[model samples]
Target: MEEKQIKTPHEVIASGGNVIKTRDDHSLILVGSDGTVLNSNECSWISDDKDNAVDNKLFRSRIEPWLTSLFQSEHLSLLCGSGITNAISSLAGAGTGTTMGETTFTNYKNEIVSAAQESAQASGREKGNIEDQIRVANDLLRGLKIIKDQNAAQLEKELNSIISNFAKSILNSENGIATAEENKRENAYRVLVNFLLSFASRTGNKERLSIFTTNYDRLLETGAELAGIHLMDRFVGNMMPIFRSSRLNLDIHYNPPGIRGEPRYLEGVARLTKLHGSIDWIQNGGEIRRIGLPFGAKAITPYLEAPGLDNANTMKLMIYPNSAKDRETAEYPYVELFRDFAASICRPNSTLVTYGYGFADEHINRVIHDMLTIPSTHLVIISYNDPIGRVLSFYSESAHKDQMSILMGGNLGDITNLANDYLPKSAIDRATIRMAELLQHRMGATSGLDKQATARQVSIVADVSTSEE
Candidate 1:
């Protein structure tokens, strides 16, 4: 990760408009010291003057500090949505941008199509993608089964095709990743690693960071591997990992002397949970298990080509293409996943920093709302745009307005900008803290320095210690 100085949004705009639909972009205003708000791309107040251009230090000075503090909370959780995949995948050929995309099996039933269209309009979109279709399909699938209709089989077949194609599109989007050591198209993987490390680089004293994502892709896991980050989930095994319901709260620790008093937390370890399940996961003999599904492989081709596998192979994948919009959390595994999410963040002094999440899942949103009930818990959302205005709407309607923070628009939401500029340099947090203590001690030894003077010295030292060489 190259360290870049804090520059203005325009100067630091290294990414494309991958996270689009900036309808609520202006909802979160960017203000500078002059009380000037920049609602547009350029800063009119400073653009004309060569030396007076508005640097994005306004965001750095404001948002970054809060994020730094939040990331250091005793309980820190990160909720990632499709926007992250959209941003990172954009680094490769044409980022698919939030849509699961279309499938060849578009011949959806009349009711399913109608429901999708209505759902699309409700979300302020002209049309819905595979997700909308699949969600409607799930609703119909359950209804058909309940009534014991003869048409249930046909609908199930169509649903399978839709889901398989949907999975294919997701795999295709992940082509940005590079498995070959020498591959040039590895920027996506690098970004993924940087993003994960930003959160995974936590202090040993605090609990392991909890990461919950709605994406079915395996980008996070791959990135964790590349970054040498150990990710712990419910699944446990060597050959085949089984999803256990127990909250073992397992973590990685090491004895300071390699054998002594209360082991210390090892760095670069995190707890991961795919809130919507994962592409590599499947239900086998009533137990959820994970398989060796290669990341970025053509979705169902490998399975179909295997010696003993058939077309039904993809069917076994545990990924259910639904966001539980209608409270579908009651279903198996998802209920447990939501329980993990709730337990992770719905505690005192918990801070959840959501990136690329748009508050689309009502079930997850409900837990977040409950988390906010804890006065010490905080919610910081960084997103491309509030397409459906849900992010902004949630903030305005919440009684705990003071506990929430929003950073929207492509300038701040893009993954590259986020890594190089916004998110706290977790690597330097402890160093800065230690240096501050040393400076305070040295200053106090010299004289009865005023509190203001001592603080100024400590702040300067911190800036120097963390700044890129």
Candidate 2:
């Protein structure tokens, strides 16, 4: 007898078995005996573009091998991990070094030992005084080691204290739900702050410098404050003073004494330009009031400053998400501020380095796209995900595919490459050579300049057009 094919859900389940059912409309459902549906076919399995997926897979296949080869070596892993651990340890210690302090001392001692040995070898003398010097050096090294150990213990205590406080704050007696969003914001701020610090350290000089962020959070300001750099947030003329005060007072310890003076616009420091209103800032009674800083440090002054507008409330300074194009008028000082920011970044030979920002906001994206159109401007997008680059690439191609061959041509890579590429070649190359020397001078410096440097060098190659003219 031929076996009856399982057709209907009831027929298949009746034989004391599970049944898989597909509807006439290509919907899939798994049903059990008692009319229990396991999975309903609400979503389609096939994606929009199978070719794109295939292309990505192929690209990954080619790139993964190279990445694996680059990172797979045992020595590379050890060195990378050691470097990261050292950095984390140093940051964890902050003003004081615990484990990092010891590591640093150990490193210094090793250097001293190597230098002394070389000196002894060159002199060709078994001088007893040299032995004594070595002993003294050893004694000093031992002292440093002791100090480091003590520091480490102190750091652990401090960390434990902080952790305990954080735990107490997070676990409320009343509400069972955690402040997860607050924590996430805090974490995001930390990450952004670190990136800004790194950027400032790299680009800051005795020349003109500025930073503009559309975020309302004080993360950038906090990071700049920790790094001992003054952060100035540009709001509407009315809102500037309050925002400035709030940012300045974020950390009382870091706030410069007597901050009542006129805002001294300094060069070579972190200038935070907040296109949108800040979290701590509030518009009240035709005036702006900036509240406590991060970690809840209250401002000494009221910080209730007003811009030049007569109707401050009507001015609409804060640009929230989903802001319509109708809001982009001269009446809106915040909008004007964003336009000014775009102008500042679009200056000759100016390079904009963006971190974690997807440029999805049409307003910001349009500004960036316009900047790219400028012959003198370069854009360096540093995103953890490919979405920013992909979007930018798409825009670039859509706008100027005929003119420029590369999509997102200006060193559009990940965070590390973005940091390395944004600076002058001389600076980056010098850093590279110095780092190489530190690691092992015997290896010598890596030959050939990076792409940016090479491009600059080529542009300056005898000025053939001028010669012809």
Candidate 3:
């Protein structure tokens, strides 16, 4: 038997590389940032077992210290994708369904699958599988829309249904069931919101919390409103609010009336940057206008064909799933919005904390990878399943894994259990302390993920005190 070769981070960087791309030996051999080879294949920071469980104190002990460290940073940003919405939807009694692509193109699934089968038969090889064919059909539909052909009518109709379903699903969760006692369970959104509130009280840092989400839903908006927090989304007008990118650049500062009072920057304000177009947004004469009505109310108008071409504009404004997304993102509003996301990642001392986001989008992933190369930047990925398999090749080939932290499985589920746990406590002070405990214990760690990365600043800890954060 021959001993396998391993590469160190220094060697990888000295070789004019920043990530570990691959290995000649296809077997599972874990490599550290210092280039040490270990028998294990999992990331040093996370465990491999799907059923491994950690108590609330231990889970809190693991997450809180890291969160505390993040709070210590002058610049911090939170980036959320589809996973957060799914977690909330599940909590709201709406079961998670097929991907947005499958839901939108449900009517053409058979046709697409048949086409793939025929192509395989013609080629006498495994060519377009069902998934591949579905992708191709979606791309074809997107191309038709881009060219302004009438053939995309069906695609538009299918998209309307998907948007309406998503709207209704998210809106229903707005009222939300009481989960105060259930706080001990790991609910992503619940803990995220609570953590933001708690951190705001502990730190006088007046810097606005930049929340960048890919979802078009209004759950977070409603959540913030219900909590009585100031959420600045850059739409200024009251009667008919229009999105202005410049408004986000403006800051609010308060000066004390007394001579000795120091000027204070307003805290607890969050700037929401919706990278993908929001359901409430409609383009009028090239300007993005927002409807003050609820998302569910606005989402169904396209399907009704209510009044005239004016009403039809709402449905046409949606950015559908599949290949068209890249092109749609380049258009007005989205282009500006995506630019904000890119800029947020590059901020100094910026720690990009992600929840429920799978690094599926190439464009978004590219920005993150670029940011990692810069100094004083960190990436924390918390997922219910293996979060690094798709990026393992990239990590293995690069020398920049030192700033990356991957937390998978255990109590790292999309929603904090405490988010669902509703309890009755009249004692505000005591309940606050108990609430903190519940939020910490309720986590859904990554589970059922295939492969894991184990190089660089990664370590697996059974005890919560192991982290220095």
Best candidate, lDDT: 1
| Deviation in Å, model 2, residue 452 alpha carbon | 15
Q: Which ten-residue region of model 1 has the weakest summed lDDT?
A: 15-24
Pairwise lDDT winner, candidates 1 and 2: 1
**Best-fitting candidate, scored by TM-score:** 1
Q: In candidate 3, what are the lDDT values of residues 350-394, reduced to their tens digit?
A: 777776665555567767888887888877665544333433444
Which ranking of candidates, highest TM-score first? 1, 3, 2
What range of 10 consecutive residues in model 3 has the weakest lDDT sum?
454-463
TM-score of each: 0.79, 0.40, 0.62
Q: Cα lDDT of model 2 overall?
A: 0.36
Pick the winner on TM-score between candidates 1 and 3.
1
**lDDT by residue for model 1 (1-469), tens:** 1212323332222222211111123234443333334343533333444443334564555556557766767798999988887776667544553355543443455767788778766554566667777777778878889999888888788778767776776777665444333343477677778888989887666688999999988878878999999999999896667899888678787876766686767989999989888877766657777777677775554654443233335666777744535456667888888888888899998999898787766667778999999999888888876665667667767887677777666666778777877777866655655665677688665445544333423433443344322
lDDT of 2 by residue, 1-469 (tens): 1113444433433433232211121332323333233333331322445411212233233222222222111111000111121222223332211110111123344654554544333333222122223323444445656777554444334333432332222122111111224554344335434444444432212223456655443434545665566554443343234432222212112223687553332322544556655544555545555543333223212222334333332112232222223253233346555655675665555555554454534556566667667675544333333322333344334453322211121122222332233223323333543454454455455355443333333322222223223
Candidate 3 to truth, TM? 0.62
Supply the global lDDT for candidate 3: 0.51
Candidate 1 ranges beyond 4 A from true positions: 1-28, 31-53, 101-108, 117-128, 142-150, 179-184, 258-261, 304-312, 324-327, 436-469
